[model samples]
Target: MLILECPYCGVAADETELSPGGEAHLVRQGPGSSDQELESYLFGRKNPKGVHFERWRHSYGCGKWFHAARCTMTLEVFATYSAQTPVPPKNVINAIKAKRPDWEGWT
Candidate 1:
């Protein structure tokens, strides 16, 4: 079972207690954006087999949202951080690197 610790509430919650919010740190397309940009933003998502960053909402617990760095293939959670973070923190990146030396890193 997939489990993640809520950074806000510090609760280790299972997947059932949380809500997956798709890929994290997406560049949102807004008004004045071209059709291609909008379409790409909506559909051009990376379904990588390795390290992935994603958003999660602790619905059954504190009801707060956060971001998590994890391995999609092994389900190994590297770290969790605030959703407001624009990019993965240094520690989280280092953690991923320590485990996955060849990880291309966040784009």
Candidate 2:
């Protein structure tokens, strides 16, 4: 039972109230890009076992999409930020590094 804090509505929502929107901050590859770029954009994914960034929509509450930095292994949420952000915030990155010192950085 994952409890996600909704930044918009200030509500702590259960997993059932949210919708997973896949990887966050993906660089979209369109017409001007090469075939490989397009393929990567469409299918390339990070199936990491550790800290990861994701997009989630609060379906049963504010009905807004937001970004979340969490650990895939331990199910620990590092932080949440606006979906409009192109990358996870610096603090979130630092937090992950604190937990996993060996981590190089978020790609």
Candidate 3:
């Protein structure tokens, strides 16, 4: 069972208690953006085979959204952090690096 700790409420929520919000740190394209840019924003997303960062809403708990760093293949969770940031926290990145030495760093 996939579980994630809510950074806001500190609840160790199971997947049932949370809602997956797809990939995180997406740069939203707005008005005046090129068609390709808009299309990318709407369709392009990272589907990594290893470590992945994603958004989650603690719907059954605090009802807040947060980010999580986890392994896609093994389902191993590294860390969770606030969604307000534009990128994953350094500690989270380091944790991932610790687990996956050849991760090639976050893109």
Candidate 4:
């Protein structure tokens, strides 16, 4: 069991209370896109190995979407924030590695 800190709720929650909401903060395309483009956009996901920005829903609490910086290999969570947070997804990983390289390991 892991405790997830919710930025909005200001409390740590059990992992069971959350649902994996897939990739987070996907860049939106401009209008006038073709079918193939829309299909590719909807299907694409960042299935990376190291740190990744993932969407998670607090099913048992506020029921709002939140962003989490997680490790795909170790399944460790470094930080969590509300959907409205302005931080870029890619920057989260880079910032973590910059602060604590040992925690992430040889980035």
User: In order, what is each prediction's RMSD in angstroms?
Assistant: 0.8, 1.0, 0.7, 4.0
Off by over 4 Å in 1: none
Q: Which stretches of candidate 2 lie over 4 Å from their true place?
A: none
Better of 1 and 2 by lDDT: 1
Question: Which of candidates 3 and 4 is the stronger one according to lDDT?
Answer: 3
Q: Write the per-residue lDDT of candidate 2 for residues 7-73, one digit (tens) a residue.
A: 7888998999999999999999998999999999999999899878899999999999998888898
Candidate 2 CA-lDDT value: 0.89
lDDT of 3 by residue, 7-82 (tens): 9988899999999999999999999999999999999998999899999999999999999999999999999999
The candidate 2 region of ten consecutive residues with least summed lDDT is: 78-87
Give a tens-digit lDDT track for model 1, residues 1-107. Answer: 99999999899999999999999999999899999999999999988998999999999999999999999999999999999888889999999999999998778
Which has the better TM-score: candidate 1, or candidate 2? 1
Clashing residue pairs, backbone N/CA/C < 3 A, model 1:
none
lDDT values for all models: 0.94, 0.89, 0.94, 0.74
Task: Decide which is better by TM-score, 1 or 4.
Answer: 1
Error at 15, model 2, angstroms: 0.5
lDDT value, candidate 4, whole model: 0.74
lDDT of 4 by residue, 11-40 (tens): 687889988888877755557987777776
- For each of the candidates, give the backbone clash count: 0, 0, 0, 0
